[model samples]
Target: MPYDTERFDGDILFGHNSLQVVYFYSIENIIRGWAQHFRHDASKKSFYHVDTAIFEKLWRWARRRHRNKRWQWVKKKYFPKGNGRSWSFSGEVEGKRVYLFRAGNVPIKRHIKIRAAANPFDPEWELYFEERLVYKVKETLDRQWQRWRLWKEQKGNCPVCQQKMNPETDWNIHHIVWRSKGGKNTMDNCVLLHANCHRQVHAKKMTVLKPCPV
Candidate 1:
């Protein structure tokens, strides 16, 4: 007697790929399993089967239109690139012709590193992960201030005036505000002056020279 295989329907058990025919308790479980297997392992040639009869009917209808279109699109857009050869769907629902690279060639470890560095707050991390670069620079006058600390200790006076002034009482940070009112926070914009010289610069009682912009 020839064993007749009826087309799948909502509640029928159908054997696939010579496997044991088992009734699935729910269609949802079968569909979910198909999605997971497809994402993780299905490639240019791999696919899975749904034993539930209703799903099989729906799958056949879908295969004629949407599935076939998607398979064609995948071949063009998302196909893996390496050799000159191209891959296409074999249309088999089980253990189809598929290509698998060696485990070492896969970028699983690099993907792990990317996931680790990802910032949770960034929405882009939900798509892909990468790192940001940052740099910091210090101004020259700030460096000079540290070098002048020894001079203040020895002379206790403004370098220009040579008048005996207390280090704590006279030394002040000055900004040579520009004629265009462009004040900079750089060391060149600053000068160590005695309190009187500092007041003179601000009060404009003496010549107010604009410091060169660094």
Candidate 2:
């Protein structure tokens, strides 16, 4: 998603994780534009939800020339899942696998984010959403969700102080059973703690409430 790389690739828009897109592009245009695009070196493992139409076209074209089984060699390698009706585009390009991701597949109410920007009157309204807003919103939500889940696992209280814990403040994932005593690195064996509380527990100044299931 870095704009500084002189972004391009057919109708494909490049985004995070070396991505590409082919929204509303004909197969011919997609291929030609991608081949001629600048900054070709930056994209290597293009992992994203690619247009399925591209795969459909290739399948049809190959079916005309070779046996169906033979043409499916690459497909089989990439999409070993059942039925192989994948909603993504992934394949090797000059010994490198390129991926394309579709924004529509985002399950977290993709429509809300989409329609919020799809103002037909001013098409570029979405682009004018201040600076780095999309990244900020996504990151904030993910962090909040992570913090809440951690607090919930601690049964809503700090074991050492036996008081309600706050997920909003600085916290640490402390091991309920110390790793040195052969504890497994897992949620069941872990507890969330305030940063100060964690430090005191590790410093052996405060004893943690042990056998505090979950």
Candidate 3:
């Protein structure tokens, strides 16, 4: 059983009045263990892929059991300095009991705080997860690039020279406008240009434009 454990600093106080009962266990450990137990084949050593429903049931069961044991211990040892009846147990359910421990007139807040262990397998898991995410991003980018290329081919001729366009290496989409001149990346702003004509347009613009337009 591959499990990770960590010390939890906080305690859980249940019932109407608060009773301090500490619980310690990693929810991640419980999840991984549960996944491994219900894996498809008993003999085969493969990664587990349990459904979310089964995982939730197992996690709740484990939490309840741990809480029950801690509650019993606190209930047995509740002895305040002045009060004889320091604490009271309401009832027990599924091996766990609810207790009430009062401090003066006001009751302490009931809360359960569990610290999760730093998973050693997290780096490996992230590597796989990120790879999948990047693959989807790249696929979308490639499709958009192809669409832009096809649209440029259909636009007929170069906008600058008004010459017929060639598909292969000659025709390309020119930012019919320069992006630095507040031009948008939309297809309407783009124009098809032959490779040499596109080069001439850029070269001429660079030499003709004044360095300071002010």
Candidate 4:
């Protein structure tokens, strides 16, 4: 992620929040959105095909990082050269196929925003989008990123109750180790749950396991 240094004045620092912008391909992501049926196939091989903009940006970064290196060295180390032909990156991962994809593909069509200043307790900030086409951006982009990460990690099921969580409404993040106890905000420390299930866990009615199983 790039730093907010005076409106695009700072260096473009890549990989600050890499997980937010890079996604693994899943049935939920293909077909412009999610499909009703989806599963990970371990037999497939890993593949990567980035856009032109991404390719250029990465090449520029590589060049800057390896200022004294030859162009051939840069190409060999940075870009993928398969069969001495295809420049797209691809490989085998433990005899299984994986993919690295670009981010921010989720749709956000027509919508409305409201900031109710009178509601002191909540501020009543809200956004509404056309259900069939758009997503309602939550309070923060980090929240949305976490939602997508958890959704992909758990395959859209709440670990607490083993139930399907509503994409737009039901899911919530729970910290395995609380921030007050020195828990850092990372995938390993966070788990997704339904809002009710979250309450249940807090009430001692349920438990969540680290490295949550699907």
- Using lDDT, give the best candidate's number: 4
Residue 178, model 4, lDDT: 50
Per-residue lDDT of candidate 2, residues 77-126 (tens digit) = 53333323353355455666544433222323212354554542342332
Q: Candidate 4's residue-wise lDDT over 30-147, tens digit each? A: 3222211111211111111113344455556557767999978877754556534444323245654343332223222323444344232221211111111113425345457766
RMSD (Å) per prediction:
24.4, 17.1, 22.0, 15.9
Runs of candidate 1 with Cα error greater than 4 angstroms are: 1-160, 178-180, 208-214
**Cα lDDT tens digits for candidate 1, 92-148:** 226443322221122211111344666634533321211111001112233555326
Candidate 3 wrong stretches, greater than 4 Å:
1-155, 206-214
TM-score, structure 2 vs. true: 0.34
Q: Distance from true position, residue 21, model 4, in Å?
A: 32
Clashes of 4: 2
- Rank the candidate models, highest lDDT first: 4, 2, 3, 1
TM-score of each: 0.23, 0.34, 0.26, 0.35
Ranking by TM-score: 4, 2, 3, 1
Most TM-score-accurate candidate: 4
